[model samples]
Target: EDQVTQSPEALRLQEGESSSLNCSYTVSGLRGLFWYRQDPGKGPEFLFTLYSAGEEKEKERLKATLTKKESFLHITAPKPEDSATYLCAVQAIGSSNTGKLIFGQGTTLQVKP
Candidate 1:
């Protein structure tokens, strides 16, 4: 089975603080890794896509990197507005015809001003 697990279910950061969260995954065959940011009561917004080991993507103060067995999301100098849930999902080979994603429970980040 393909599965994703995120650590530190929640985090609290002071404004301008930087940190990195982890996502561990197990799958029969890895196809893709996805990162998303979701605000309260809203749907997830796509952030990055990592297809292979050593691949990395960045947006604003966020950077996402992928490895064979895990992925990491790093936040730099975050602001209060950056508070949101960071989600990591994976697409596994032979899991879907349409390349659907299975998501982790998510890491909720709270940035204090």
Candidate 2:
């Protein structure tokens, strides 16, 4: 069965510390992988979309990369403002254009100043 899993469940980093969050997935056919950031009591914010192995996207302190079986979200010198829950999700070809997504459990990051 297709599934997604994220590691560490939670992370705590000192201000200016860098770290990486992991998301691993298995699916019959991958259409896209998406990353999102959610703060408490708010909807998730779109971060990146990876379509194939070796694809990457970046925004400020965050860089996302995709491989056959996994993806990574690398944070560089994160600040307290970067604290949030990071989510990874995947859409399978079998879902057609309905945009159904299978989401990982998420990794909550806390950056302390």
Instruction: Say which candidate scores most in lDDT.
Output: 2
Which lDDT values do the candidates have, in the order given? 0.92, 0.95
- For residue 14, what is the lDDT in candidate 2? 100
Per-residue alpha-carbon lDDT of model 2 for 1-113, expressed as tens digits?
88999998999999999999999999988999999999999998999999999999999999999999999999999999999999999998874547788999999999999
Task: Write model 1 residue lDDT over 1-113, tens digit each, in one string.
Answer: 77899998999999998999999999888889999899989999999999999998998999999889999999999999999999999988882536989999999999999
Top-TM-score candidate index: 2
* Count: clashes, candidate 1: 0
Error of 2 at 22 (Å): 0.1
- Give the Å error, residue 107, model 2: 0.3
